[model samples]
Target chain A: MIKVDNISMRFNLGIEKNFSMKQFVVDLFSPSKRKEKKKKKVNNEFWALKNVSFEVKRGEVMGFVGTNGAGKSTLLKIVAGVMKPTEGKVSVGGNICPMIELGAGFDSELTARENVFLNGAVMGYSRDFLQSKYDEIVDFAELADFMEVPVKNFSSGMIARLAFSIATIVEPEILIVDEILSVGDAAFQKKSEAKMRSMISGGTTVLYVSHSAASIKALCDRVVWIDHGHVKMIGDAKDVCNEYLRSLGLPVEGEGNGA
Target chain B: MIKRVWLNFKKYSFLLKQLVARDFKIKYKRSVLGVLWSVLYPVLMMIVMSIVFSNVFKFTTEGVSYLAYLLSGLVMFNYFSEATNLSMSSVVGNFSLLNKIYIPKYIFPLSKCLVTAINFALTLIPLYVVIIIESFSYPDMKLSLLHLVLPYDYICLFMFTLGVGLILSAVTVFVRDMLYIYGIIVLIWTYLTPIMYDITIISNPILQSLMKLNPLYLYINFARQIILHGWMPTPAYFAACGGSALIVLLIGMAVFKMNQDKFIYYV
Candidate 1:
């Protein structure tokens, strides 16, 4: 089970642009454009998420549907334990296997074989478990012959296949995925979807964020529609996804109206 | 705090091992000499310094061979320099990884420091080689069982380096200025530590006294006592070396803890 209560995330939009002390000092001594900025001690706070809350029950598959910049990824990161929310609390009561940005722990200089072990360790799998699953990962990725080659030499598609293969090797109690279903070529995508279904049916709790409305309707038991950092709607997947797609001026599956 | 750190370390111990090995493999992957480069690097530096200091600076150790004294001080200072320099950028260098998944943020800096620690241990081979060669020349060279205490001194030195490295790594997440300024500070710090010259030759009492306050100076001085003078440190000396390291470590851990939650936002 997972609980997210009253979560908010704030970003200081322009802070990193003026990160240099030399630039600040130079601007301080000058009297032109930056003078007004210096007088106010310069701040640009943008709230990325505001007062949002949700819950995922054990063995439930929940989908998040939103436009770009709707704070879906930020909420996923908070639940994944990578980022701290500015307000509110999140409690996840099981082991998490996050597939946020696949290949997060890979070093390009390392071989595929080495990255399998390193990337697995980063996701909290023990070396022994990874060793036992090594062949399975290679077989699924279909890189058995290329395991010894450095990851830098692998094509982009090959790398993504390897990353996806290493990430889903375990049946985690809580799996937090972020827009990662589209990996490798078309054939590989079908295989990975099958793999995902097996994991979901094996009683794993899932929090999935994706752009594909069909995958959400196919896999999610429930869907949360977020608009501008607010939970716009939450209920059964088919209804919420229909409403979500309709709101964007696209025709719903069983409707004749079009934007 | 200790228990929490131990638990975190235990949980990530395999990750830490891979991180260390990843760097080790990358560093020597393209080189023909492989890890022998670590041993050869200090010996080569010692050769160049031996010529310049002996003839150009004309500095001399009264009863100790300059080669022995020079290499001992160089080995310890080099470890400190490399560890802290690399550790300072550890957090920002792994921005992609840190933002994507949850990692014990300290692991970045800790892994870099551990890699340098391995190289530092290997560099001791060069230092001992110099010691063996100088034993043939310097009549005062007494190869006794007391020299085994060198590894104990290294443990204390490692703690001090890691303490300083932790603080630098955490501070660097917010202040990009530290990245540029640390290079200049290290250059000045090397000159102030008496690594290339004899400290006793300075006539000014206050300047000499201030030099003694440097932690690197204290570490080098402590190791020299075991290697050159064959003297076991007094309990006060032991307490001073170990105590300062412990205090810095406590402060480092505290600073890292307070600032770690804000790191993701900044990085």
Candidate 2:
């Protein structure tokens, strides 16, 4: 289970036209010259998240949908514990495996097999466990032949597949995936979704973010619609997804929200 | 707080090993000489300094051979500089990893220090070789059991480098200009630490006391006392070296912890 309690994040965006530390230091000593630049203030404070509160119970696949820059990624990052919330607290129970970005910790100069252990270690897996499960991960990714090849040589799709395979090798208690469902080719996507289904069946709580409403409808038990850094709506997956689509001016397929 | 760090250490030991291993592998990946560069670097530096100081400056090495004296100071100083310099970039260099996952922030700088420590160990082979060669020329030069104290000196040096590294790496994330500024600072620091000259040459008591306050100088003096002079260091010397390490480590940890949470915003 994960709980985000009244969390908010604030960022300071610098507004000066030609701001540099060198110029700032120079301006510090010369007060008369600094007066000209005083018209443009240093920064503008903006809130990326505002008092967003939510809870994900164990064994629930919850989906987060929003437009670009709606703070979907920021919320997931806060939940994953990579970024601390500015105003509130978060409590997470159990091991969390966050696949926020494909191949985030990979060393391109290293081989695929080396990265398997490297990435697995980052996920807090023991060396012996990874060693035992090494072959299984390789078989799942179907990259057995390219295990020795450097990841820099691999295609983006290949890298994505490897990242997905290593992240899901062991069924984590909590899995946080960010728009990774559309990774790799269509066939591999199907395979990855099937793997996720099995993990969900084994009682893994998942927090997933994606732009595809259809996938959210198919997988998530409930959906949280976020807009302008606020929780716009939360309800059954179909209801929330349909409402989200309607807001986007996209046609609502088949039946309405009554269904 | 200590317990949390310890638990994270236990959990991420494998990841730390992988990171250190990756650093070592990447350093010599396409090079033909491979690990030999570790030894050759100090040897070349020793030869260059020996020629300049022994012949041109006519600097007295006291009773020790100039080559041995220079090599000893060069290796330790080089290790300190290399470790801290590499670690200064550790956080900024691993932005991708920091962005996607949450691991203890210290691990990046710590891994950089460990990799340099391994290379420093390799450089010791050439240092010892210089000592043995000098032993044949100077009858008073003999390897003693006191040389074992060199490892203690290395431990102190490691702690000091790691402490400074932690502070610099954390600062570098916010101030990108730190990279260029650190380069100039290291150059000046090398001259300040008396790496190529004997501290005894400075007859001023005030200057000598100030030199004693330098942590690197304390570590170098401890090593020289054991290896060059074949004598045990005074207890006061140990206190200076170890105390500086401890104090700097505490300060570094405090600074790093305060700034780490805001790192994502700046980076």
Candidate 3:
């Protein structure tokens, strides 16, 4: 469903320029040894994603396991076509619903109902289609009574619930989830996992990035471990999860604590 | 092509409608007279300019009243200032969507123009009342000059606004100083464009030639010619304004498209 080839992203650290001489001189005499610090703030390229390549077949639940700053989110963003890689290419052949950020299209002044339609439109659902799925979305979100209320007034959990409901309402061909399940209460998290499982079973390919090996084992059919923006391994979920857990110094299977 | 913009317009038409309605509501949200603020601003400016310049710059308005002459130019000038200033920050200001979605980037600026157009339309009511009152008061008033309210000038002004807005938006992405510099520029730009004074009042020939080269000067003149002078601009004025707008729009689009890929990184 998606292919990435030698994708890399280099960001310039000293992105802002054209500081005035007065401000520069003021910084030179600041209270906390400013001159030394200012001298070190030169433009440098930091690679967020380095020459990473991978593929996900149709209906495959692919887990992207990586530590913090492992470029997992960057890879997902490239696949979602929101950010272009500085080098190489990422080609995706499906309608992609990227759960990159919750409440991305929500207007604080707008009501929950208005936001659902707006967010659905942003996620590529036409008005008629959103209208068709409206009931199910509201039901899944469990916000039927508060449908007319403004989203800004909703609690953080309510907002996440609504956002997740809108994203999963339509059965997209490719779903890219980044840390979305990390939100909500435990029961809601279980509901989210169930919904994803249902979608995966019915031929929706998913690329889920997470730091939790347990979540990956619970959801994915295949696991692709990434370390420092490079693919570490790609194989069956159990083997990769065992290897990853072993690397983290955790005992495998029955050797662990009470479950 | 116009078709792509046309399609985007159709696609975003509902959002446009909602935003325009919301903008009107938001602008007048707390005021007693609501949208009346739009007309009040230009009317106040017209009165001030007419009072300030009437004694010093004595060019007969042919038969038009001084206030009429001032109002016509004031309306068009407001359109340019409002459109360009709003557009310069329109993209970056809405970084939420610009960073996430893939839609026509020009929509942000274009939407600003559309909102300002609504404001422009509302401002015309006072001008109409002022013109009628002045025409009745002055026996020699050139009623024929009212023909300048033709829709074509509005189109020309809008196109000019769009072209300039796009360029300013693109430039602002690279140089953040533009945000502050443009406030001073608009103040100076209004005087340079002959909004309050007549171009013929300038005794120097070089300044007259230079005014002809200034596209905003030409646009304001085009609006004034139609509304106060009651005649369409010469083919040369049309060619100059249209040609310059097209060139700026093309260059702006090119720069916007080239740098669009880097917006996520920069933002």
Candidates in order: C-alpha RMSD to true structure:
1.9, 2.5, 3.9
Model 2 misses residue B193 by how many Å?
1.6
DockQ for every model, please: 0.79, 0.66, 0.37
Residue-level lDDT of model 1, residues B1-267, one tens digit each, is: 789878878888999999999988998888899999999999999889989989887988888889889999998999999999889999899988989999898898889989999999899888887778887877556678977876767778888888899899999999878998999999999899988788988789999999898888888888888777778878887777888888888788789889999998886
Give the alpha carbon lDDT tens digit for every residue of A143-237 in model 3.
99999987779999999999999988888899888878755789898898788778878888998887777778888899988888788889998
Residue range A1-259, candidate 2, lDDT tens digits: 8998999988766533344778879999999878866643433567888889889999999999999999999999999889999999999998898988877789999999999999998888999999999999999999999999999999999999999999888878899988777788999999998888788768899998989988888889989888988999988999999999999998787765564
- Which regions in candidate 3 have their CA more than 4 angstroms from the true location? A17-43, A185-187, A254-259, B1-25, B55-62, B137-149
Docking category for candidate 3? acceptable
Give the distance in Å from residue A257's predicted Cα in candidate 3 to where it truly belongs.
6.2
A92: Cα error in model 2, Å: 0.7
- Among all candidates shown, the one with the greatest DockQ: 1
Chain B TM-score of candidate number 3: 0.87
Ranking of all predicted structures according to lDDT, beginning with the best and ending with the worst: 1, 2, 3
Q: Each candidate: how many clashes?
A: 0, 0, 2
Poorly placed runs, candidate 1 (over 4 Å): A22-43, A257-259, B1-5
lDDT of each: 0.89, 0.88, 0.78
> If both were scored by lDDT, which would come out higher, candidate 1 or candidate 2?
1
Model 1: per-residue Cα lDDT over A1-259, one tens digit each: 9999989988877777667767778887876758666544445776778988888999999999999999999899999989999999999999999998999888999999999999998987889999999999999999999999999999999999999999999989999888888899999999998998899889999999998999899999999998888889999999999999989987778778454
What is the per-residue lDDT of model 3 for residues B165-256, given as tens digits with 9 covering 90 to 100? 88788778777789999999998887787766677878899988887788777766776666555566788777777787777667767777
Q: What are the per-candidate TM-scores when only chain A is compared?
A: 0.92, 0.89, 0.87
